[model samples]
Structures are given as structure tokens and as C-alpha cells.
Target: MDSSPHKLYHVHGFDSRQFLEHYFSDKSDMAFGDDVLKFPIEKLRQVFAVGHINGDILIDLSIGSLIHHLYSASEFFKNIIVLKANNRCIMELKRWVDERTGAFYWGHTSTLLQEKEENSDQCQDQEAKVRSAIQHVVKYDLEKENMTDPLVLPPADCVISVWLLEVISKDQDDYIRYLRKISRLLKPGGHLMMIGALDITYYLVGKDKFQGFTYDENFVRKVLAGEGFIIDYCNVKERTAVSDLTDYKATIFIAAHKEK
Candidate 1:
């Protein structure tokens, strides 16, 4: 967006605890179980479907405040590097990784992933494994020449981006540009797993509103093909419309591999 960054609601304006409580709280009445939880569960299942994605390095270009996607990846990647858009999100994630005070509880999400994977039911064990796997939490700017500039990073065997481009991009062209930039960080033929909200324009954090780009499955397929990625798996889950927390019609997950 050409608009001033100050007017935009980036990670600093985001309240991590409030976001989780509102959308992912364990309350029985919350739609977290039905609508929100399926996105991560299905995404993780696709990761497994790819068959033996375990590798040395994994780069996460996701919104750092949301760590649920990392649960499944942590098991496959030996070293996990997370790139955040702002300082607030970095701090929020660090609090949980460092075991500091007032961190948002992600045990429920960890348990959900564990059970879905047929792993042990111990939530604490799963949490420990994720914490151990995450090696770094650093800053990243999608607009920068290199997403992780100043600090040189190794080409990752797998790159995971979830609900990031839609939130940061101003339009379709910008979204494709951002996608291509992130794809550059992957090793040739390496996997690129992404999750997005289909046909969403905006989402709110507390009283502030953040913009999102709208797109469909066909657009995603076309863009990936244009960017020289071979799609291995793609699917969209129709939203249940239980709450207006976000104005998305569906949740799309795609798993692709960069062509050599």
C-alpha cells in the first residue's frame, strides 16, 4: 500500500494475547474448534502427505504471533528460522519460546496437532519439542531486497508462509511479487507450503483494522505456475461463517516445490 506505514496496522498494533483469546480461546462456544482449527490441521496433514519432508533447514515466513503452523514443521526440520514483520510480533513469539511471563497459551493448539498426528497426548512434550526446534526469531521486511537482509541465511529446504502475503500486500501484483521474493529463499526443488484466506479484504485487531488481499484457488495456481513452482497439493476449506472475526470465504493451503 502506498499509504503511510503509520496508518497501517502492523504487528505493533496487534495484540497477540487478545487475538488468541478472541479467535482461538478454549471456550466451548468459540468457533476456534470448528472454523479456525481445521486450517492448521489440514495444512499439517498435507505436509505429511508430501512424504518425508524432514530436512536440515526450514524458513518460516509466517506472522510470528501465530505459531500453530510451526507445530507440525518442528518435527520435520532440524533448524527452524522464523522471520517476523515487526518488533511486537517478535517479542510475543520470543516470550513463549523463552518461557517468559504473560505468554499466550498455545498448549491447546499443540495438543490438537499432536492428536491429529497420532502422537503422544502429552501437550507439554509437544511444546518442548517445538521450543527446541525453533533456532531463531528475527526481523523480516517483505519490501526489502532480501526478505532477511543484513543477515545472510542459508537456502532453506522448506519454506512455510501462512496468512502473511494477504495481510501485507496492497493488490494482486504486490501479492505475486511478495510470493516470488519469498520463493527465492528456497533451495532448488525445495518445498514451499503456504496458507491464505480466500476472498478476504480485511481483519481487525482490537479496534484497528488491517487490510488483506482477495484471491481464489485458480489465481493461486496460476501465480505459482508463473513463478516456476510445481504444485504438489492444493485445497480450499469453505469457511463456516460462524463469526465475522475475518471476512474470508475460505482457507486455502498449497504445497509446491520450486523447479530447478
Candidate 2:
């Protein structure tokens, strides 16, 4: 495990601009376009549209560098708390949240989401809604017994963890442990949404290589059920040959509710 303070899973000098350009933007150099980016976003939209997802509090257990998943979620949940594993990720996200100079532009993502959800292409209004709905952006440690220690937050009504477990977990055992730890933050019968890379070992960000835990859809279902969650939705998108950016074979998206 890389326990170094500065080299957390998603915080090794990660370039937010480079990340956005590589994955979300329509740059010619990007290997894939809307096909890859739209998969998780659209699946998440479907999960939230089911009408049971609304609540007073939603906790984002994401790595903090990506904000694409928050567009639809912000409208349904009254309060959103973003949790980060490292300072660098926290700072990058804060820049966008505060609309500081040099913040990575997310208007493209906002516009896409708006068009899909409302059938309108307006941008700034949706972005403003996300910024206003975010109540807290705080640090979290998956290794800790209480993921958000020292801050006694109430159990959340919904928790969304996107592309987090596979990247941070060192192995299958670690993945299950981390899942249980975070799931504890949810109230019984509360919902959990997770996105992960399937059958991959590593990913590239800028010039740095990040490790990932290799697993498939069956592993995801088994682990969530073991942690007292009832799986409701599970979908996987096979990777297109257009991108050599990572070793992942597929992207998995899941939504489940904790069993009381």
C-alpha cells in the first residue's frame, strides 16, 4: 500500500486539465469520445431517475477529482458532501467549486447533462446548481475505521462512490474492507451507487501510473451483498478499441440499497 501522504490513490500530482482533456473533451488526441464518458453519466442518470433516490443528504465518496457524476445528483439531494482522499484532489475540486482562476472548465459536461436531462442545452444554470448544492468538501481516509473521522456526520441517505474502490484498494480483501467501512456511513436501507473499472490493474494520469484492483461484475455483486446491500441495478460497458489510455476491459456501474 502506498501510504505516503502526498501519493494517495488519486493525488499524485494529478493534472486536472490533462485529465479533462484526455477523457471528457473533444480533443483530437483523445482516443475515445462521448461513447466512454457518457456511459457512467447516463447510467447514473437512470439510477437517480427511478424516483427513490431523492433525500436530505447525499455523500459523494468519490476521489474528488471528477465532478461529472454530480450534475444529476445535485438536483435531487438537498445537501451534498464531497469526500476526498488527499489534499491535492481536494484543492483541485475546490478551485472549480469556488470558480477560481485556472479552474478546469466543466461547462461541457454540464451542458451535456442538461441537454440529456431537461432536453435543453443551457449550461451556467446547471453548473450553478451543483456549486450551490455542495455543502462540504472534506478529506477522507479509506484505511481508517471511520472514513470521515473526527467529524461526526449523520448517516447519509444516499452515497455515491464512482471509480473509487478499484483504484484505491490494493486487493480483493482490501476492497471488501473498504466497502464495508464506507457503507457504514449510510443509514439502513439507504442507497449506494458505485462505478468501477473491470478486469484492470492500472491506469494512467498525465505521466503517472496508478494501481487498480482487478475484478469483474461477479465480484462486485458478491461484495455488495456480503456487506448487507441488495443489488438493484448493475450494468457494464465493454471498452472500445479506440483507447489504449488504460488497461481496463470494461466499466461497471451498480446501484444497491442497504438491507435493514
Winning candidate number (TM-score)? 1
Please provide TM-scores, in order, for all candidate models, with all chains considered together. Answer: 0.91, 0.90
TM-score of 1: 0.91
Q: What is the lDDT of residue 40 in candidate 2?
A: 64
In the range 24-78, model 1's lDDT, one tens digit per residue, is 7677766646556657665776666566677899998875377777777776789
The lDDT of each candidate is 0.78, 0.78
**Which regions of candidate 1 deviate over 4 angstroms?**
1-13, 119-124
Clashes of each: 0, 0
Model 2 ranges off by over 4 Å: 1-13, 118-124
lDDT of 1 at 232: 84
10 residues in a row with least lDDT, candidate 1:
1-10
Q: Write the per-residue lDDT of candidate 2 for residues 49-149, one digit (tens) a residue.
A: 77888889999987547788887788799899999877777788899899999887777676666667665654458778888989999887665677678
